[model samples]
Target: MHRNLWSGFCLSSLLAVFSTLSGCIDSRGIIPQALRFDDAKLTTDQTIRKADRTVEWPRDQWWQAYGDPQLNAWVELALAGSPDLAMAAARLRQALALAGVAESEHAPQVKLDASVQRKHWPADRYFYGPGVLGDTTGWNNTTALGMNYDLDLWGRLRSDTERALSLAEVAATEERAAALELQNNVVAAYIQLALHHARLDIAEAELKQREQLLELARERLAIGIGTQLEISEAEAPLPEAHRQIDLIEEEIALTRNQLAALAGKGPGEGARLERPKLSLHGEPALPSNLPLELLGRRPDVVARRWQVAAEARGIEVAKADFYPNVNLVAFLGASSTTGDMLNFLTNGSKLTYGIGPTLSLPVFDGGRRRGKLSEATAAYDLAVEQYNQTLVAALKGVSDQLIRLHSLHEQEIFVGHGLETAERRYQLAEEAYRRGLTDYRSVLEAQSQLFDQQFLEQQIHAAHLTAQADLWVELGGGALTDDSGPAAEQLDAHKTTLHLPGRH
Candidate 1:
């Protein structure tokens, strides 16, 4: 018999069971072997160099390299308390449970049944007990063993088992994704808080310089040398700085509150983060030289690809109809009739098993069954498309991050020079003001320049770090840390997490 002939027969049966998803799939649409984005073509690859040395992150939790104890403690606390992580754990168990279910289906189901009964008869009633009607009525006991099995019958059960296993893998990937996202959010929030604090300090220092200038200007005005407008202008910087500082305080409070919730702690109850520090592993390396092919290794992409295959199997399972199916069912368990277990063991002899063959062949079903098969077919196609799209999106994110990282690192370098210049000017302005050659206005202007430059530095540094974090994610570490379960597995030799579906 032709393989396609049998496949069609099985599919016809599926049409009866599953509802047809009309128009969900393109009937004539050629599902391109879902194209992976050409990453090499997209990226302008270059090595990033730091003044100190060459650095490569090597998939380790590079964030720890910064040596900030406070940052470490906060991450630990948040990991333990995060409800989202807990939820992801629960999902992992669920997937594992489903795998168990599929595995169990491959084994025979065993059952034991027992019962007891008491009956009273009228004084003149005729009653058939086990003693009277050959064990039809009770005080009576009966026992037997039974079992049943569904033969593979065109590999439907096997496909089902594979589908379940794939689903479990997808769940594991989702867990990893969740962990990565949770940690990223925590780090980002901490950076934001640190940035705000640094800004506030800058503002305050600027304010103090302005206050000194205001006092000097007012004194000069009293002696008719400084204008009233000059004193008023000198006073303005202090309030502005104070207001900026107050705003930063509000942001810090908000960030702390968010961290508290994420860490599963009350506000101000856990490890406090000091000023943020940047620990970047030199420049990030693109995953493998072949960027497009490497995307298959990404957990998110692989997980969804598994779904596509599983859906294909589901369609096959539904199609199990076109061929004749033979089932082998038998029972080999002790069954007892009578409330007393003792009587059944003593009175009934133990018996072993029986087997029977049940066959099913599709005759006709008004195209209903065929419709279901088509529906599954369409679903598989849809799944494949979605998987491809996710891969593209993942590649795009990586490319975008690399571009940003390159530019931001350069921007920071330039900004560093600007800051140095501002510092030098501030130093010169102080001497001039003391010598009474320059007005207090020059002192205030120099202070403002220094403060602004410093503010830009903090922001640029944080932006650069964040860009790296995102790049790591896009490259498929997706938050794989040295100690993490899947992350550890992916890097080290134990259970391999490398299931790239489309990659050669």
Candidate 2:
């Protein structure tokens, strides 16, 4: 009867312990309200023209749309070598490692401990004063294996791990954003360098023409057909032309150095690089309708969305802290005070072991737990606000690019006509002066007017190219694919399972 009773007690104790560990408080009911935004309000723009509707989706290799091999090569180099990209990748790795740490917390943790020490105990120092232990001196050795498992009875560990997982996703999106930014910057710098190159060519050509006119003026004056004032006026353009050339050269040098840095190389690295002749086939095509789904393709938006999810998980973690914490701990060990230290390893040595579950309940925390929960909720609110702000900014960015492109295209037509008229007038003035039908001043005025128009055309062309680049960047640097559909929609499928307040 006693044997049966002992067996029943052991079985009952095991069942009780297992039952305690298996129970988890339901905290999902208290999850904050869903996050919402009007899709039409975010994507609807009054500035999109009908022409923009005749567009297609952006390509993954959008830079290739410019049709410049050198430009494509440079961008690839930057992507491969840029230090900014390297750092972003490192951050992603770190976040993933931290996520691993959070996961490890949910698993059983085991530790081994061992110690050996030589000690002399004098019983005389205690109640006996002279030789209580009988000069007890020996080597004490101990070894133990301990195991612990925290019973997540409130989903605290799960919530913590979810937060970490979301953070890792955030890091990955941030890296993508960094890469997009780097590519855009490199393209812009290359465009500027090409503009300066065109400027230099124009300046040199103008200087040669101006020098020819100066010679003619000097010849006319010597023959008493031209005044010294006409000669001086013609001479003035030569120095201006030289100055323009000097400035353009300096700008080209600076731009090359900038590109080199973007490529993660020394300044001198740009010296051997050739000038880029990047030209666009046409303005990049755009999707007829931009939905909120497409807008989420922007890395910044995705990262922020992930951040909001992570913060929401943080709220769950804080709430879990208000509940009781239970942990199962077990230890097995042997200790021996014999002169032979290895005796601890023998089964004959004294043994000590313990195994049990521990429970802790908060009684008087002075509102610390409540304060933390409040803080987490506030953080979630901040993340949601930031996400909204980013969405608005992204929409505005696309609209701004569209407006600028439209204005530049309209101006291009007018600038082209102006350039042609100025060229004709300069030709007429030069011919008249050669035949002694007009003064040198008329020729100088015509030359200056023509130079201004030519420079204006180059500036406008560069602006057009840059506007195209900005548009591509706003469209997520062509990172989206048809398979992915829209980034927001893709995130939605996963977001549905998350405890965040946001709704697609």
Compare the candidates by TM-score and give the number of the best one: 2
By summed lDDT, the worst window of 10 consecutive residues in model 2 runs over 495-504
Q: Give the Cα error of residue 377 in candidate 2, in Å.
A: 0.9
lDDT of 1 at 213: 76
lDDT string for model 1 (1-504, tens) is: 699999998878765543233222222422224443444565433431120122233355544544456666777777788888899889889988987888787777666665545444333334543343343444544455556577776887788888888888888888777766766777778767666776777666666667877787887788777788878788776766788888888887878888788787887763354555545434444333345543555678878878887887877676665455667777553444444545656636355567776666655566665677777777777788787678667866766786787788688779879988998998899778765678777877887788778888878877876776677667665333322222111222111011111110
- Global lDDT of each model? 0.65, 0.80
Model 2 lDDT, residue 439, Cα: 83
- TM-score, cand. 2: 0.86
**What is the clash tally of candidate 1?**
23
Q: Candidate 1, TM-score vs. the true structure?
A: 0.74
- Model 1: lDDT equals 0.65
Question: RMSD, each candidate, Å?
Answer: 10.8, 9.0
